[model samples]
Target: MTKPAEAQALPDPSGGDHKGHRERLRRRFRDAPGALPDYELLEMLLGIAIPQRDVKPLAKALIRRFGSFADVVTAEVEDLRAVDGIGDVAATALKVVREAAIRLARAPILNTVVISNWDTLLDYCRTAMATLPMEQFRLLFLDRKNALIADEVQQTGTVDHTPLYPREVVRRALALHASAVIMVHNHPSGDPKPSKADIDMTRVVRDALAAVDIQLYDHVVVGRKGHASFKAMGLL
Candidate 1:
């Protein structure tokens, strides 16, 4: 009697089918052309977050909603949830990616002298702060030579405003022994243009610090569009 055709066609149970597929993907990723497209990179990342499902559609949806890789990673959790197939798990995954990017961006400013890397410093500050839906006031404390000592979030407020106290800023600088400082905040409105109040508040902080012999290096306004430096603009 002849054996059944279906049984004859089946592969041996010991064959490494599961491992082979993953190795093929790994090889393709390593050998792929310049810049392994966003989807592929995202696919690899999502494979960690969602082990059992196809993540292409979700990744594509995120890109479509947020416009680019950076924007998607930086998007607010609520905005991320608005996309189809994005739930708590996906939102959390995107947030983890964003947090990693922020930490990477700030690495240069952490131990090294920040004054020398002004661009990276601003990029770090902006990337780290601009994702918030509400306003935030942050201070980057620096030593006498302008090396970063600590980065602190002083206050968080509503979508439009954050209460800032010049006296408190000065006091904190004194306590930290920070000879110089950089002030940074974000506007949820996506315009980096500094408002009159922003300028006024910056002057208040600057003057207060100046009285205590602490330099106010810059007041950086971060928004989705970009960042503006008050000192560079001659506003300080």
Candidate 2:
């Protein structure tokens, strides 16, 4: 009689048995998502972009380098790519997550009376501007009822300075038929405190808007550390 053929071992489909760990993570997330630490959540996110390998170490490394899960997702694509295991695909994935978060934060304030939702407005502004690597000046145009008409970036400049033209701001406000405006900008240095220049610029913009009967609601400066509001400080 011929000897029975030996059975061959099949290859594992979960990329070296990582599927079990991933499944456990999924179950954990499903059961109690809030219980999972930032690194665990980040590991799961990275796993979706990078398959066929253990990604726990990579996730931990990213959290370490970026300081937190929020920082990791908000980091620039080029900066994300600088990490050892991150490629274009992974960087794009992170950016997509960031965009989703920003849009979600922004949704509640749109077409709503901004002063009534001041905290939400600040949350949205911080989500959109806090992580930027350069200065970006934005205008929040408001209708007669103080509802948001449009949110537009007026200028982007180097890490510290962005040129602002009061005339351009007035022009945009008039074009949008906005009766009020809120200014916003970011400080890459992670300090939300406005410099003398910021105060002077806000004064100029306020005077110009007043000329056209447009109210200056506030000038908000966002940074990684926190945010500041001109109105809150009695500067507006």
Top-lDDT structure, candidate number: 2
Query: What C-alpha lDDT values do all the predictions have?
Result: 0.80, 0.88
In the range 26-104, model 2's lDDT, one tens digit per residue, is: 9999999999999999988878877666778878999999988888997777788777778776778788988899899
**Tens digit of per-residue lDDT, candidate 1, span 49-152:** 65555565667777777667767777777787666556667678878998898889988778678989998998887788876678999999999788899899
Whole-model lDDT, model 2? 0.88
Give lDDT: candidate 1, residue 216.
96
All candidates: TM-score: 0.77, 0.87
Which segments of model 2 are wrong by more than 4 Å? 1-15
lDDT of 1: 0.80
Stretch of 10 with least lDDT, candidate 1: 3-12
Q: Number of the top candidate by TM-score?
A: 2
Candidate 1 accuracy as TM-score: 0.77
Q: Pull out the clashing pairs in model 1.
A: none
